[model samples]
Target: MTIKEQYVAAKQAYANWGIDVDAALETLKKVPISIHCWQGDDIGGFEVNKSELSGGIDITGNYPGKATTPEELRMDLEKALSLIPGKHRVNLHAIYAETNGEAVERDQLEPKHFENWLNWAKENGLGLDFNPTLFSHEKAADGLTLSHPNEEIREFWINHCIASRKIGEYFGRELGNPCLTNIWIPDGYKDIPSDRLTPRKRLKESLDRIFTAEVDETCNWDAVESKVFGIGSESYVVGSHEFYLGYALKNNKICLVDTGHYHPTETVSNKISSMLLYSDKLALHVSRPVRWDSDHVVILDDELREIALEIVRNDALNQVIIGLDFFDASINRVAAWTIGTRNMIKALLYALLVPNDHLKELQEKGDFTERLALMEEFKTYPFGAIWDYYCEKMNVPVKERWLTLVKEYEHDVLAKR
Candidate 1:
């Protein structure tokens, strides 16, 4: 069938199934796009070249060296950003100020590296997805202990945040842009029972510091919207994230949702919906699924592809930032990164084309089972259709369309077989 015919067939099939096809496709088109650094190590020579899938590797380890030489990082980032397709960029890494042979510091990233990075991003016609402070596994394993949460850890966290603020100044004044910062708290309870209020209090105090800087100094968006990081595999107790969200909203800070951080038992769609319901001010840290690890893979699963698209389409939250949280070693292929990113974009377009009315109806009447059923049914309809639609929308040539179709068909067959 022709591409248009295929879209029509898919639409008609959905209609036959009592779902609104047009509304589903329409919702898929409105999401924003971004670039992330999942493959930095590959480019940096830490990982073997053959294992590198993308041009770079993820700075996933506790290497204090990553942030020490800001100039080296800037050159590498410039090279990577030159490869991206758009004008906006976002990156997440655990960087420190220590030199090449220095011992890794827990929270020792020099704020200047971030400033240089932001400056580079601005110069390169890209925006920033600046995840200023990330956590290490050691910290995750051994939760940060504070004798007086209000006095000690709070101060340390604030100092780190101030460093981030100093970087924000460059974005606001020098770059004429804003940096997107996400605070993913790795400080959860260890084996022992801890006072939830203390950690929460510490988080709030730290956030207050960041926001105070944001409000007082620079005009970057990151300052005003304190991105609250919550509930990693190790950090949060059962209700810690929910409480954090409540607290952040109460204090005018935004909840930054990382796709892979939640427990396997939690429904991501529900969590996203809940966050959106509270306030439109939000940020997203996107990645793939994992049982224990926060595998920063480009989202490719059919189900998750749809959910990610929906998050962008349902832009109730005015500020939506797309993040590729994948961090692999250097031996991986750059082609894989391109394909994964393209697939994500394709899925988003498909979601946008989906009829919003169908989602609304399903949401209105769907119980748990019905909702799952609806999501499953409505998922692929738009993704496939939109993929085809976008090629045409972009004015792809007929020959290119045929080649793409052949590849997609081959992929689908292999996936099924």
Candidate 2:
């Protein structure tokens, strides 16, 4: 049967469970996932310094044809977006700012530095999300930023974050969508630190100073991200989950949950409901972690499905900002972006297709047998059929067909680089 015929059969199957396949597709299309730009350039931004990645973050492989210029990066991103279905936003690091061949310090950055990006986003009908580049700089060489002991260094990073917020606000004001500005620092020690409270205290103070200047909430929102541990911070991390959760709650800011930023066994899916209880909204940096914080390309795994289910089941789809965060330079950069994003969307689609209310009612009524059986039955549902229908409707390649476009681009465009 044709794709549409298969979708009709799947829709009829879901209708037996009182689930509307059309409504699920519409809801999935409306949710926007912010695609990270760093995946295309291996986290190497357009800055003139071009220093190696530092501050506990590392990209493992060295695939050829990584975008080296602002124009090239945007072109690659445009290609990746074409293969992925759904409306999406682009997440930008402060280091990606285009300065027109001038040396611009991070603290001295302005919205003008990203005017090119703003124009590009506007043209593409995409919203922009911003991040302060707190790592891979001279000041962050010690693997400490925003919580650095040196007053001068801390002040410098603080100013940079403040400037980043303004730039984010500018993007939101221009694009008519609120920009989420997230702060993630790699401040920790390789070995045990005598005093952990001091760094956190300093971090709090610095964040307070950076937030002192009020920007319109309609334009920009602030978020803090926590890390379990990093490459050089195995012993102790300053911005632990506990620290940022308290800070975000006290300050009424959004807390970002990165899937790869937790312990091997810990999952961010469980934390979504708890975070939604207090905060009006939250952000997510979805990536796959094999055993640790490896930032591998995301796939449609069990944890990913659970994360999507929690967001949908709790009725927090509108309240949570979904974003991709992974840099795998070992494979085709464009293909990596396309694969990870398509998987993210697929997870959400699968969650939307589930009869969440049916399972919830079964559990609440203490019908463990039915609930277990129904859950297992859903595993065999024609989810892929509905996914193909959605992709076809969105005018994107279905299944592995997107790989054809990626291969063509690799030969024609990436090979020239």
Scored against the true structure, residue 225 in model 2 reaches a CA lDDT of 96
lDDT of 1 at 380: 50
Q: What is the lDDT of candidate 1?
A: 0.49
**Window of ten residues with lowest summed lDDT in model 1:** 47-56
- Which stretch of 10 consecutive residues in model 2 shows the poorest summed lDDT? 48-57
The RMSD (Cα, Å) of candidate 2 is 0.7
Q: Write the per-residue lDDT of candidate 2 for residues 283-382, one digit (tens) a residue.
A: 9999999888888999999999999999999999999999999999999999999999999999998898889998999999999999999888997899
- On TM-score, the leading prediction is 2
Candidate 2: global Cα-lDDT?
Answer: 0.94
